[model samples]
Target chain A: MADAVIAAIPPGRHARLIVPRLLQRGEDFTARLLIQHPMETGFRRDDTGKVLPANVIENVVLLFNDELVFRGRVLNALSANPSLSVQLTAQKSGTLSAHWRDQMGNVGSISTEVRVAGA
Target chain B: MPKHAQRRTLLGAVAAAPWWWAAFVGTASAQSSTAGSDALDERVRAAVLVRGGLSLDIPVIVETGTSVPIVLFADPSQLRPGVRVTRLGIIAPKNPRPVALDMELGALMSQARIATNIRLGASQSVTGVALLSDGTVWQQSIAVVLTGSACYDGT
Candidate 1:
């Protein structure tokens, strides 16, 4: 039986990070990336008598042909998983990069090499 | 004032700093709740700034918090040469802690998409706060409903 890895983020809870690679033709490609960030509502508390700190992933970016494409910031009002679907124009495939940044100045960047066999 | 008085003043100043901050946070939270029914305070909100364009909230309707999926529309191509979404935050009135999760947006393009999981507290309104490079702020909000739902996560 083939093995499958499941990446799931708890409901109402935020994610830590996510990286996705989009592959199309031999020379063209699209990279879909995302991170898990709990849209902290700043309400609940732990065992201690103090309130818990808020944490969530916010920013995102997509690169194609070493150029920039989709870009936007995530707000506190968003739900759990930041579902993003961007359109990337592929030309002379070099490398497609997907990057995600959170509120705490943390960043996660992943890249996929492009290989176009057919002209 | 006498030397002893000066010392006492210094001690008082040092001692009441956290208290003042706490008080300020409390009052601000209270005021925000009062001023805008759904508005959270700056302290509780963990207010952060972003670079270039701000990433406000991602206004949308959520059925539950367990498997929440968010969507955005800002054109990443318009962003300057080097910029990234650094942080994301969300807060609600019913949940225990105001924060849900935090992560890093590594060195990548501005046009990217993502999806994740989340835990919810009853049916309440949620907010999304995304921070960017160079210290700027963007935000989004959404309302969630939990019909016939019970808090059963025994973790």
Candidate 2:
């Protein structure tokens, strides 16, 4: 009866995933994914001086046609909306799935398809 | 000695004698709970940053925390055609923890320009790194000062 509310992670904006609509095989492919999250390092405090909970998507997994490929872990050094780019062999056309989970049980998912058939 | 304990001991040590070790096992692991953070530094260096390349150090040390700036400019002549920088990250040697930032730089559409805020854990030398079209890594470092820490309180 209620829609799922996607609240801000805290310090982070929110999560976003980007990728090319089509990629040519035999050439380097760039896959981009951005995550908008509070990415709290569990270090800062609120106006009331409360140590915010450490909430960040610590792990990211990329699946090409259900095959594990690119994965990343968020560290304290990353900016607000974390981004990822990886070089993948454009061998075949398939579905690209990206999943990220934070320490606070928050999850983000994105998927894209590839057309590696010639140009 | 128990069977499991004896076998485990033998596997852990070359001669069953502990010389020394860190809590997290490897140097990177010990420095930061996250693995693959240290090697990411060396990898990015080999992939993008180079000499002849202009290095830009992002200077912003706030407790609120954001990705610091560190950019590299390489001669387009040196880059292979259609080679886009897939990701850029920052590496620190003395931050008491690994600080890594990742971003998808639109290579095909835009010129090489990566400028953004980065999260700093502490005062230390931060290296900017990038990954190019061929999976090669390139990086350059800049020293920064931190009034407060973001990772753990080593101050």
Best by TM-score: 2
Which regions of candidate 1 deviate over 4 angstroms? A1-119, B1-63, B72-82, B110-112, B148-150, B153-155
Residue-level lDDT tens digits of model 2 in B12-115: 55332211112112333433566575664443233322533435456644443345544444345656776755555555655434645444443332334444
True-contact fraction in model 2 equals 0.25
What is candidate 1's lDDT per residue for B42-115, written digit by digit as tens? Answer: 33344443233333333245554555554432335635556666544444555554454433344433343333
List TM-score per model, in order.
0.40, 0.53
Every candidate's fraction of true contacts kept comes to 0.13, 0.25
Candidate 2 differs from the real structure by a C-alpha RMSD in angstroms, to one decimal, of: 11.2
TM-score of chain A of each: 0.56, 0.77
Docking class of 2: incorrect
| Residue B113 local lDDT, model 2 | 45
lDDT of 1 at B133: 63
